[model samples]
Target: MKEILRSYKQTPASSIAARCIPITAKGVVRGRLRPITGDTLQNPAEIKLIAEWREASADWFTTRFPLSEAGTSRWLEQVWRADDRILFFVEDEECTPVGQVGILHYDPLKKQCEFDNLLRGRKGKFGNIMIYALITLGIWTIEELDVMEGFIRVVADNYRAIRMYESLGAEEIERTSLIRLEENGVTRWVPGQPGSSPPPERELATMRIKREVFLKLHQSNLPT
Candidate 1:
């Protein structure tokens, strides 16, 4: 029974160092974005929610790309171990884990960090709760950590995600081209060329949310 209970423990990502504190926007709203920590989540239901998130994530990514279950699990494990990556589980009014998000701080030379979300089983307006949490966290990180800029790379086909970033005042920086090749006898032609039957390059749209805009938004939402 002890071993089974240990297996059910909700382990926090190793990136965040401090204990998570419940934060509210003046009106004392429960289950907003909180600092990520080992003890942040105490409920077994939340752990189950996170497990569901992991399964859903594996399914989603595998359906989109050629990844094995082991590969996906390993990838998530590495992401959880990174020190510069801050991960948080977004909660609803009832404090239920609805989604997860994180900030990956890049090198100073890069002058940018990327924010992403794995929102699973979201309901109603709470669906966009991860976006709000991310934007708030970005502002806090910028002011407190003195980061220069923040950016996110979203797939061109993810229209909802693109729109959410845009709503947060993030602007498109560039569209990355991804080319995949098969080892078969035939050579694949480059994208944007006619009659070559080449594998089309995926457009990865990068958007930037500046520090000033982030601060302004956060301040506006704060209680006067």
Candidate 2:
């Protein structure tokens, strides 16, 4: 899996292409998950949509900062160049871009990854879009990437997201204090740092899910 990811990172952005992951419900296709690549960023509308989604969902994340189109482009370009990261924009049955999901910190040896950037860019777009997108990514990790387990860290106060993960078979494995730090105008919550003290409200919940467990729970809904 690491070799595959390393190869992907080495590939030139212009040469990279999006992959289609079928999102199914009860053996029926509901939507699709498309990997974000340099080609995907070429479309102004698509890029703007992604930026907007990220900005709107900023509060739900551990990091919060002002977002700009250029900044978004730079951030995504870096992701495209990273060996251990991949993100996908979710689409509905109608093919409307609704949100994004990604996995990072991939450890090939342990076959483990951390779920990142799970957010619905558009409000009232698809009620269960995140769930479908998550399942799609999980399938890719287990079936395609050969990852055995996955983890996700969520802000302890973010109930909505926590509920969603729990519903999808994730279990809380640990709780870590978040040290809030502000540099320039951006504010972020880090697990810890030298000479840092965490506020009581700044807590993060780490959750884990096994590949076999996730697949077993959604096996019927998965496509053949």
Candidate 3:
């Protein structure tokens, strides 16, 4: 029972630090964007709501993450930290949570950041809430963080998402195989090795956008 329970339970990602940088920005679809992590999601009601979104979007997560719910939770906790990890939760004007996006492995010296999981639940229904989330985060990365460049590894099969990012001036640079592995109950992605075990692998194409180019396109009014 314990083992089974660990495999089926999922939790939301959160910041572990006492003082996290606050995020506030305007989202296209509805309201505005606010950063959320374990530290900010203390209210049980909101936490449960986030979990519900994850459950409702299980098919999405299962396909991309390919992990048990508990594994997903642990991975999320590992990703939510103070130094370089950034997780932003979107909320509407009515204060209803829409979705979340984040980045990891921010290299200040190199002035680059890798895109983390960018997911927003439309309550299991179909909507463009994700586009709004991406726009909000993309703007933040270029404008606020002052990063020179950013890259995202998206599944090659996710054409809709790829097209959306491309419309925002992201260019597909390269394609490679990425494997999802769980280490010590935490799930993470790594490049596949030769003669190693075949893991949950995907053909991921790396898309990149420069700060100047993306901001320039946005200034000219990115595809609405």
Computed on alpha carbons, the lDDT of every model, listed in order, comes to 0.56, 0.80, 0.60
Q: Point out the higher-scoring one by lDDT: 1 or 2.
A: 2
Q: For residue 207, give model 1's deviation from the true position in Å.
A: 0.7
Q: What value of lDDT does candidate 3 attain over all alpha carbons?
A: 0.60
TM-scores, one per candidate: 0.66, 0.88, 0.67
Lowest lDDT block of 10, candidate 1: 1-10
As for candidate 2, its clashing pairs are none
Q: Write the per-residue lDDT of candidate 1 for residues 1-224, one digit (tens) a residue.
A: 22211221234545332333233443444455534444433344555555566656542221233434454444555554555565666666776566776677544455566775545456624544665566556655564456678888776667887887788778998875544454443232223433334535555687988887876766655434
Clashes of 1: 0
1-224, model 2: which lDDT tens digit per residue?
76565554454555543446777766767788777766765677777887888887787778888888888888888888788998877888887777888899998888899999998877434577778789888887887788899999999899988999988889999998778788888988878744566554477999999888898898876656
Q: Against the correct fold, how does model 2 do in TM-score?
A: 0.88
Across 1-224, the per-residue lDDT of candidate 3 in tens digits comes to 22211221222333222222222333233554555555443455555655666666553332434444455555556654446766666655454567777777677778788776666665422255566557667766665566788898777778877888898779999987767776674455557765558654666788998888887776633333
Best by TM-score: 2
Off-target runs (Cα >4 Å) in candidate 1 are 1-18, 21-30, 34-51, 54-73, 108-111, 118-120, 124-128, 180-197, 222-224
Model 2 is weakest, by summed lDDT over 10 consecutive residues, at 8-17
- C-alpha root-mean-square deviation, candidate 1: 7.9
Ranking by TM-score: 2, 3, 1
Candidate 2 lDDT score relative to the true structure? 0.80
